[model samples]
Target chain A: MIHRFLFHDINEGLIRHAKRYVLVVIVVVITCSMIDSMSAYFMDYFGEYWSPIEYGINEFYGRYPFVFDINSTDKFTIPFGWVLIYLFLAYMIGDYIYKDMNGYGMYMMIKSKKRWYWWISKCLWCVAVNVFYFGLLWISNIAYSWMKHGDIAFYQESDLRMSYYGFGFDNMGMPKLLLVVIVMPLLVGIVQSILQITLTLIFNSVATMTIIAGILMLSCYYGSIYIPHSYAMLIRYFSNESDPDFVAVDAGTGIAVLGIGIVAMVVMGYMIFRKKNVISNR
Target chain B: MKIELKNISKVIKKNNVLEDINYTFTGGCVYGLIGKNGCGKTMLMRLIAGLIYPTSGSVCINDKILGKDISFPDSIGILIENPEFLNDYTGFENLKLLAGLQKNVDEQEIKDTLTSVGLDYNDKRKFYKYSLGMRQRLGIAAAIMGKPEIILMDEPINAIDEDGVAIIRDLIRGLVDKNRIIIIACHDKEEMDYLADKKILMSSGKIVKEMIV
Candidate 1:
C-alpha cells in the first residue's frame, strides 16, 4: 500500500516537474532524427561515389598497397544516431536529477514515507521515456534503410552490425542503458542536493548551491581526465571486452555500480532532507 | 489537529534567525504571525510546514514528527514565499495539479475556489500573464482547493487589491468556522488587525508579543 502511494507520488512528481521539458525533449528528438538522416545520406553518397577516388589517392600515395572496396549501402548509419539517442536520454535524466536536487520539484516525493518506491519509480520512468524515444529512432532508421536499400536483406548483407538496435531490444538492455545514463548524473545530483540542503540550512542562500554544483562538476570532469593510464586501462578492461563471458561480467559489474550509487544517493538525500529546515522561500 | 514547536532555535552561520521559540497551535483558530523583515516569521512558518528543520528543536503535528509519519498532517495546505506556480501553465491547470495531491478534490471545487477568489476560470491567459493581484488570488484558490485541515499563508495579501483582500478575509473566516487552523505570516497591521483572532509578534527571532486580537 505504501509502495503504491510512493509510485503515485513519483509519477505525480515527474508529471508536475518534468512535463515542462516535454517541448525541449521533442525538439531534441527532431534534431537527432534530422542529424541521423543527413549523416545517412552523406554516408550513402560517399560509399557510392567517393570511395574509388579515395582508394586511388591512397594507392598513388603508396601508403596503401590495395584499393579498399566500400559498399554503397552499409547497415550502420554513422553511429551518430546511437550517440544522439544516448545523449537525448542522458539530457532528460540529467535534467530530472538536476531539478530534483535543486529543490525545484519532487519535494513532496522526497517527503513521502516510501523512499525505495519513489527511487525505483523514478528510475523506471526515466528508462521508459528513453525507450520510447529510442523506439522512434529505430523506426526512423528502418524506414530510411528501406527507402535507401529496398529491403531488410540489404541491411543483413552489409558488414555493418546493428548492435545498438539489439541492445535496445534485449530484456536487460534498456535497464542497462538507463543505469549508465543515470549513474553519473544521479550521483552528482544527489551529492549536489545534499550539499545544497546542508548549505541552505547553514548559509540560507540559493546562490551557494549553484556555486557548489559548478565547482563539483568541474572538479569531477578534470579529475576523471587526470587519472593515470594504468588505472584507466584497468577500468576499461572490466567493461570493454567483447567475449560473451566478459559481457556478462561487465553487465553484472555495471549493475552493482549503479545500485551502489543510487542507494548511496537516496540515503544521503534522505538524511539531508530530514535535517533541512523548511524556512520561508527567499 | 495541533502543531507544536518545542524550544526551536535556528542559527545560520553564527547569525541567529530564531532563538529558543516554543509555541503550540491547535485546530480551529486563525493565527496572525506578525514580525519585521528578517525576524524569522517565514522561518517559523516553514518549520511548522516541515519545509525546514530547526537547529536544535522538534516540530510536531498531531503528536508525530513530520518525517516519521506516512503522511503529513493528512491534509495541510500552504502557500510559502511568492506562492510559486509554473509560469507557463494556465491557472486552472496549476490548480488541478495541486488539488490532485489529495483525494476527492473535484473539478467543481477547483472552479468554485477560482470563482470565490475572483478569478475567471475560463480565461485562456497563462499564469505568467496574471497581474500581481491576480497571482495572489490564484494562490489563495490553490490553498483552499484541497479543503485542507490547516492552511498556511505568507503575506497572502501583499499584492492583492481591496476587493481581493475582502474575499480572502471572508475565506479565512469561513475556514476557521469549519474548524480548520489558519496561520498567516505577514507584516500588514491593518489586515492582521481585522482578521487575526490571535497575533504572535516577533523581533530578532524572539517572540516580542502575543496578544488576543
Candidate 2:
C-alpha cells in the first residue's frame, strides 16, 4: 500500500511540476539561436550541408585543445552560453522541492508519512524534466536540419569536423551517434540536476547556482575523463578521434561516471531531506 | 490514538519558537489551541505534523517516535498558516490533486467535503481567482477531506463570514468520531468555546492554561 502511495506521489510530482515548463521553453529558444549561429558558421566555412547529429555535437562541444596553465599569459575562454543552458536547466528544477515543501509538498509529505519518498519523487522529477528538456533540444535540432537538408541523416562530414572542431567522426555508426548526441547529454543533465537539487538543501538557490556554474566552467576548461561534464562534449570522445592536444574519454566510461553520480546525489539528497524541517517558504 | 510531546522545544535562528512543551493529545475530541500572535501555535502544530523537528525533544504518535521511527503521523491532514495550492487549478481540482496521493478519499468524498466547507465542487474558477473566504474554505476542506486520523488546521476560519463560520463549526462537529483527533488554533474565544471540547491557551511558547469547555 505504501509503495502504491509513493508511486502515485512520484507520478503526481512529475505531472504537476510540468507547469514550470515555461522555463524549458525559454532555454529551448536560447538553444535554437545557438544552433542557428553554429549552422550558419558551418554553412559559411565548410560550404556543406551538415546533419542534425553534427549540429548537436557542436553545441555540446566546449573549447577543444583545452589546456589550463596557471602561469600562461593566455586566458582560458569558458563557454558562458553553454554553461547557461545548464544553469537555466538547474534553475528550472531547483526551487521545485523547496517551494513545494513550504506549500503543497508539506501536505503531501505529511500524508505520505515517509520523507524519503519525497526525496525519491524529486529525484525522479529531475530525471524526467532533464529528459524532456534534452528531448526538445534534439527535436529542435532535427527540425532545423530537416528544413535545411532533405534527409534526417546521421552522416557526418569528417573533414569539416577535423578542420573546425579538431575532431573527426571515425566511421561513427548510428548507435555511437545516438549515444553521444542523445544519451550523453541526457545522462550529464540528470547528474548535474540531481547534484543541484541535493545542494539546495545546504545552500540557498543563488549559492547552489554558483556552485553549479563553477562545476560547468571547470568541466569546460578541463577535458579530464574524471570530470562528468566532459562526457557532454562530443569532441572529447576517444571514439570520435580528436587532435592529440585534447584529452579523450570513452563514452562507456562517461556513462558509468554519470550513472554513479546520479546514484550518489539521490542517496545524499535523501539523507539530508530525511531530517529537514519543512518551514514556510524557506 | 494518542500524540505525546515530551520536552518539545524548537529554536529557529536562536529564537525560541516552542519552549519545552510537554503535552498529550488523545483521540475522540476537538482541541482548540488558543494563543496570541507569534506565541508558537503554528509552530507547535508543525512539530506535531512532523513538518519540523523539535530542537530538544520529540513528538511521538501512537508509540512511534517522529523523526526516529516515522517521518510523520500514519494518517494526517493539515492547513498551516496561509493556505497554498496550485494557482491555476480550481478548488475541486486542487483537492483532487491531494486526494490522489493517499487514495483514501474517493471523488464523491472530496465533493462532499467541499460542500461541507461551503465550497461548490463544480466551481469553474481557478484558485488564484478565489476570494479570501473561498480560499479559507478550500483549505478547511482539504484538511478534513480524507477523515484522517489527525486533522491540523492553524486558522481554518480566517476570512470566513459568520454564516460560513457556523457551517464550518457544524461540519467540524459532525466530523468527530472515536477514532479521530482534531486540533484547531483559533484566536476567537467564543468560537473556541463553541467548538472545542478542550481549550489549551498558550503564551510565550508554553501552555499557560488548559480549560475544559
Candidate 3:
C-alpha cells in the first residue's frame, strides 16, 4: 500500500511539476538539431549543385557533413549551438525542483508523512522527462537521415564509413552512429539533469545553471573524460585514421564517467533535500 | 491528539523568528493564535506542520518528537502563508490530488467539502481563475477535507465576504472532536473570541496571554 502511494506521488510529480517542460524540451531539441542539419544540407547539396557535379571529382575535404554523421565538427560553429541543447536541458534540471519548491511544494510536503518520498518522486520525474526529451531528438535525427539520403539510409550510411565527414575524421557506420548520436546524448542529459539538480539544492538556481553550462562549454575545448560533457559530443571520440591531434577515450571510459557522476549526484541530492526546510522557498 | 512544545525557538538569518517558547494544546478544542504580523504565529504553525525546523527547541505530538519520530504530522491539513496550490488544475482536481495522499476521503466527501465552503462543486474553473475569496475558501476546504486529526490554518478567513466568514465560523465551530485538533491564526479578534475555546496571544514569538473561554 505504501509503495502504491509512493508511485502515485511519483506520477503526480510528473503530471504537475515536470509535464510543462515537454513543449520547451521538444522545441529546443528540434530547433537545435534542425539548425545544425539544415546548415550542412544547404552547404552539401546546394553549394555542390551551384559549383559542379562531375563524374570524377576529387573532394579535398567534406565541406559539410550530415548532422548525425558522428564526425561533423562543422556543426560546432556559431555559439556552439550543437551543444546548446544543454543550455535548456541543464536549466530544466536546475530550476524544476527549485521552482516547485518556491510554489506549492510546502503544501504537498505537509500532506505526505515522509519527506524523502517527495525527493524521490522529483528525481523519478526528472529521469522520465530526460529520457523522453532525448528520445524525441533521436527520432528527429533519424528522420533527417532518411530525408537526406535515399531509402534504407542505414545501408547508405555504410558508404560514409571510409570518407572524411568533417574535420578530416572518418565517419562511423550506422550502428556506431546510433550509439554515439542517440544513446550518448541520452546519458548526458540524465547525468546533467541529476548533477544540476544536486547543485541547485546546494547553491542557487542561477549559479548552478551557469556552472553546468560553463563546464560543458569548457569540455568542447578539452575533449577529455575529466570533462564529462566531452563524452556527450559523439564527434569528439571519432577521428580520422591519420589525424594527429585526435585523443580518443574508450567508450567504456566515457560511459563510466557519466554513470559514476550520476550516482554521486543522486546520493548527494537526497542528503541535501532531506535536510532542506520547505519554508516559502527562502 | 495533544501537541506539546518545548523551548521552541526558530532563528532565521540571525533573526529570531520564534523565541524560546513553550505551550501545549489538546484536542476537542479550537485554538485562536493571535499576534501581530511578525510575532512568530505563522512560524509556530509551520514548526507544528514540520515545514521548518526549530533552532533551539523541539515540537512533539502525543510525546513523539516532530523531526525524529515523525517527519511531519501523521495526518495534517495545512494552509500556511498564502495557501499555495497547483494553479493549472481546477479547484476540485487540486483537492482530489491532495486527498489521494491519505486515501481517507472519497469523491463524495471532496464534493461535500467544496460545497460546505460555498464553492461550486461542479465548477471547472482552474485555480488561477478564482478570486481571492474563493482561494481562501478552497484553502479551508483543503485543510478540513480529509478529516485529518490536526488542521493548522494561518489567516483562514482573509479576503472572505461577510456571509462566507459567518459560514466559516460555523464550520470551524462544528469540527471540534476528542481526537481532532484545530489551530488558527487570524487578525480578527472578534472572530477569535467567538470561535476559540482557548485563545493564545503572542508578541515577538513569546506567548503574552492564554485565555480559556
Say which candidate scores most in TM-score: 2
- Cα RMSD of all models vs. native, in order, equals 10.2, 3.3, 6.5
The TM-score-based order of candidates, best leading, equals 2, 3, 1
Query: For each candidate, what TM-score against the reference?
Result: 0.64, 0.89, 0.82
Which should have the higher lDDT, number 2 or number 3? 2
Off by over 4 Å in 1: A1-125, A132-249, A256-282
TM-score of 3: 0.82
What is each predicted model's overall lDDT from 0 to 1? 0.55, 0.79, 0.70
Evaluate every candidate with DockQ and list the scores: 0.27, 0.59, 0.53
Error of 3 at A195 (Å): 2.1
- Please provide, for model 1 over A1-282, each residue's C-alpha lDDT reduced to its tens digit, 9 standing for 90 to 100: 344433443454444555544543454345434544534554464443112111111111110011123843423222222223333334444434333433323333323423344345444554455444444434443444445445433122111112211121123344543343334333333333333433443453445545554443333222222211111111222322332232222334434554565466556655554454333333
Q: Tell me how many clashing residue pairs each candidate has.
A: 5, 0, 0
Interface RMSD of 1: 5.0
Q: What is the lDDT of residue A156 in candidate 2?
A: 59
Better of 1 and 2 by TM-score: 2
